[model samples]
Target chain A: MAVVVQFAIGLVFGLGLVIAGMSNPAKVLNFLDIGAIRSGGWDPSLAFVLAGAIAVTFIGFRLVLRAAQPVFGESFHLPGKTGIDARIVIGPAIFGVGWGLAGFCPGPAFTALATGGGAALMFVVAMMAGMGAARWLANRRA
Target chain B: MRRSLCALAGAAGPDSVNTEFTPFASFLGGALIGAAAVMLMATMGRIAGVSGIAVRLLPPYAGGDVAGRLAFILGLVAAPVVVMMVTGSAPDLHIEAGPALLVVAGLLVGFGAVWGNGCTSGHGVCGLSRLSPRSLVATGVFMATAIATVYLTRHLM
Candidate 1:
C-alpha cells in the first residue's frame, strides 16, 4: 500500500513537472537565469507551480489531519527537525545549482528513463554519482 | 522542444518534462502530487518517499516490499499512458544537452538526494507540507544552488 502511494505521488509529481514547465530545461533556465530577466524572456512560471502546489497541499493537509489513521498504515510520517544548519544550506545549494544548470532532478530523471530519453539517462547517472559524493561527504564529515 | 536539440545540445538535463509544460500546467501537476502525498499518508500510513522504495530496487527487496514497490512504480508508469490517452498524443521527448553533461548532471542529483536525504518531491512537497525545518532548509538550498549553478555554468564557465 505504501509502495502504491509512493508511486502515485511520484506519478503525480512527474506529471506536475510536465505540466508546470519545471521539467523544461529552457523554462527552468529562464527561472534561474535572472540577470537577463526579460519580460517573457525571464519567465517566472515556477511561481505558478509553487502557488498551485501550496494551495492543493494546504487543503490536503486539512483533510489528512481529520483522518483517524492512515489508509495504508497507522499514522502520518512527518519530518522532525526545525533548525537551520550547514548541511541544509550547503547540500541544497549544490543540488539547486546542478538542477538549474542541468534542468533535471531525481524524480523527473527517473520518469524520463521510461521515455528512453538521452538527457534523462545522463542526469540519472550523474545524479547517482552526486549522491555518492554527498554520502561520502556526510559520512566522512569532510 | 526539438528532440535532436535535447540529444544534440548541452542544455538538456533530465527535466525534459519542463520541455512540454507551461507554468500553469506544472503548478496543477504539483498539486496533484501534493494531494496524493497527503491522501496516501493520511489513509495509507505512508510518507511517499521515492528513494526508500527505489532502494528496494537493490537486493533483499524481493519480498520485503516488492509488491508495494511494484504497485507504486506501476502507478507512475500508468499515469503517462493515461495522460496520453486523454490528450490524444503524448508529450514529445526532448533534451538540450549531449550525453556527457547529462551523465554528470544525473550523478550530481543522485548524490544530492543521498546527501540531503531526499529529493524535491520528498522534501519540497512532502517535507514542506509537514513544515519540517529540514525540508524547508533543503528546499531553500535546492533552489539557491540551482540559481548559483546557472550563473557559474552559463556565464562564468
Candidate 2:
C-alpha cells in the first residue's frame, strides 16, 4: 500500500513537471535569465510555479502535521538536521551553478529520461557518478 | 489564479519577456506537484525530495526501501508517456550545451544535492513548505547563485 501510494504520488508529480513545462530545459533557462528579469522581458514563469507549489504545500503542512501520525506510517520521515554547516551552504552554491548552467534539476532531469536523448542521458549518468563520488567521500570522512 | 499570478509577475502585454507565458498550465501543474507532496506526507509520512530518493537508489547508498524507491522513479519516467498519450503533445527539449558541459553540470548538481542534503524539490518546495530553516537558506543561496550563473553564462560569456 505504501509503495503504491508512493508510485501514485510520483506519477502526479511527474505529470505536473511535464504539464508545467519543467521537463523542458529551455523553460528553466529562461526563468533563470536574470537580464530578462531585470529588463521586464520574459518574466520568470517558474516563480509562479514555485509560488503556487509553496503556497499550497505551506497550507498542506499545517493540516497534515496536526495528525498524531501519518495515515500509513507510524512516524514522519522528515529531515532532522538543523545546523547550517559548510556542507549546507557550499553544496547549494555548487548545485546552483550546475542548475544555472544546464537548467536541469533532479526531478525534471529524471522526467526528461523518457525522451531526453543523449544530453539527458549524459546528465543522468554524470549525476549518478557525482553522487557516487560524494558518498565515497562522506564515508571516508566518517 | 493563473491570471493573477501572471499579473503579479508583470506579464501583461505581448511585449513581455516571456512571450510564451502559460500561467494557467504552469499554476495548475504546480498545484498538482504540491498536492502530490502533501499526499506523500499525509499518507506515508515522507518528504517527496527527489534528490534524496534518487540517491538512496544508487549503489552503495541503497539501504532503505529499494522497492518503493524504484516504483516512484518508474512512475516519474512514465509521467511523460502518460501525458503524450493523453494530450498528444511532445515536450520541447532545448539543450544547446554539448556533452562536456552537460557532464560537468550533472556532476556539480549531483554532488551539491548530496552535500547540501536536498535539491529543488526537496529543499525549495517541500522543505520550505514545512518552514525548515536549512531549506530556506539552501533555497536562497541556490536561487542567488543560479541567477548569477545565468547572467555570467548568457550575458557576459
Candidate 3:
C-alpha cells in the first residue's frame, strides 16, 4: 500500500514536470538566461511554477503536519540538521553551474528520460556515476 | 542596469518575453507537484526529494524502502506516456547540451545535489515550504549562481 502511494505520488510529480514545461531544457535555459531580459527573451514561466508549487506545499504542509504521525509511517522523516554550513552553500553552487550549463535538474531530467532522446540517457547515466562517486567519498570520510 | 530599464519599458508587449510562456500550465503543474509532495509526506512521512531518493538506490546502498523508491522513479519515467495518452501527443522535450557537455553537467548535478542533500524538489519546494533557513540559503545561492552561469554562457561566452 505504501509503495502504491509512492508510485502515485511520483507519477503526479512527473506529470507536473511535464505540464510545467520543465522537461524541456530549452525552456529551462530560457528561464535561466537572465541576460535575455534585456532583449525580452527571458521566460518567467519557471517563476510561476516555483510560486505555485511553494504556495501549495506551504499550505499543505501546515495542514498535514498537524497530525501526530503520518498515515503510513510511525514518524516523519524530516531533515533534522539546521545549521547553515559550507557544504550547503558550496554544493548548491556547484549544482547551479551544472543546471545552468545543461538546464536539466534531477526531477525534470528523470521525466525527460521517457522522450528526451539519447542526450537524456547519457545525462542520466553520468548523473548516476556522479552520485556513486559522491556516495563513495562520503563513506570514506565517515 | 540600462538594459533592465529597457526591459521595463518594453514589458507591455506580449512578445516582450519568450513567446512560449505557459503561465497557466506551469502553475497547474507546480500545484500538482506540491500536492504530490504533500501526499508523500502525509502518507509516508518522507520528503519528496528526487536526488535523495535516487542516490539511495545507488550502490554502497543506503538501506531504506528500496522497492518504494524504485516504484516512484519508475512512475516518473512513465509520466510522458500518460501525457501522450491524455494530450494526444508527447510532451515537448529538447536537450541543448552536447554529449560531452551533458556528461559533465550530469556529473556535476548528481554530485552536487547529493553533496548538498537536495535539489529543486527537496530544497526548493519541500525545504522552502517548511520554512527551513538552510533551504532558503541553499536556494538563494544556487539561483544566483545559476543566473550567473547562464549570463556567462549566453552573453559573455
Candidate 4:
C-alpha cells in the first residue's frame, strides 16, 4: 500500500510536469531566460508553476507536520542537515548552470527517456555518471 | 516549438501577443506536484524530491528503501505513457545543445544536485515548503545562477 501511494504520487507529479510544459526543455530554457526578461521577451511561465506548487506545499506541510506519525509510517523521515557550507552553495551553483544549459533537470529528464530519444538518453547517462562520481567523492571524504 | 521561438523573438511587452503563456495549466500542474509531495510526506514520511530519491536509489546510499524508490521511478517514467494514452501525444522535448554540451550539463546537474543534497523538486518545492533555511538559500543560489547562465548563453553570446 505504501509503495502504491508512492507510485501514484510519482505518476501524478510526472503528469503535472508534462501538462505544465516543464518536460519540454525549451519551456525550461525560456523560464530561465533572464535575457528574455531584460529584452521584454516571453514571460516566464514557470514562476506561476513554482508559486502554485509552493503555495499548496506550504499549507500541506503545515497540516501534515502536526501529525505525530505518517498515515502509513512510524515516523517522518525528513532531511537531517541544517548548516550552510561550501557544498550547499557550490553544488547548487553548478547544478543551476547545468540546468540553464541543458534545461533538463532530473524529473523531466526521466520522463523524456520514455520518448526513446538520443538526446534524452545521452543526458540521462551523463547524469547517472555524474551522480556516481559524486558518491565516490563523498565516500572518499568520509 | 516554433511558437515558443516566435514568443522568444518578440518583445514580451504588455502589448505583445502572449503566445506561449500557459499560466493556468502550469498552475494546475504545479498544484498536482505539490499534492504529491504532500502525500509522500503524509503517508510515507519521505520527501518527494526526485533528485534525492534518484540518488538514494543509486550506490553508496545506505539502508535506502530500494523497492519504494524503484516504484517511484517507474511511476515517473510511466507518466508520459499515460499522457499519450489520454491526450494522444507526448510532451515536446527538444535539446538545442550538441552531445558534448548535453553530457556536460547532465554531469554538472547530477553531481551538484547530489552534493547539494537536493534539486529543484527536493529543495525548491519540499524543503521550501517546510521553511528550511538551507533550502531557501539553495533555491536562491541555484535560481540566480540559472538566470545568469541563461543570460550569458542566450544574450551575451
Give the number of the best model, judged by lDDT.
3
**For each candidate, what TM-score against the reference?**
0.79, 0.90, 0.92, 0.91
Determine the TM-score of chain B of model 4.
0.85
- When summed lDDT is taken over every stretch of 10 residues in candidate 1 chain B, the lowest stretch is B12-21
Give me the candidate number with maximum TM-score: 3
**Per-residue lDDT over A1-142 for candidate 2, one digit per residue giving the tens place of the 0 to 100 score:** 8888788889999988887888887788788886775555554668778887888899998899899999977888888899888988999999999898888999988898988888898999988777777777888998
What is the docking quality class of candidate 4?
medium
What range of 10 consecutive residues in model 3 chain B has the weakest lDDT sum? B10-19
How do these models rank on DockQ, best leading? 4, 3, 2, 1
Between prediction 2 and prediction 3, the one with superior lDDT is 3
The CA lDDT at A16 in model 1 is 67
Give every prediction's interface RMSD. Answer: 3.2, 2.8, 2.6, 2.6
Regions of candidate 1 where Cα sits further than 4 Å from its true position: A1-9, A129-142, B1-23, B51-56, B59-66
Which structure is stronger by lDDT: 1 or 2?
Answer: 2
What is the Cα-based lDDT of residue B11 in candidate 4? 20
Tens-place lDDT per residue, model 1, A1-142, is: 4665666665666676666655556666666756535423556777667667767776787777777777666566555657777666766666675677667766556656666455565676666556656665665876
Top candidate when judged by DockQ against the true structure: 4
Candidate 4 Cα outliers beyond 4 Å, as residue runs: A38-40, B1-19
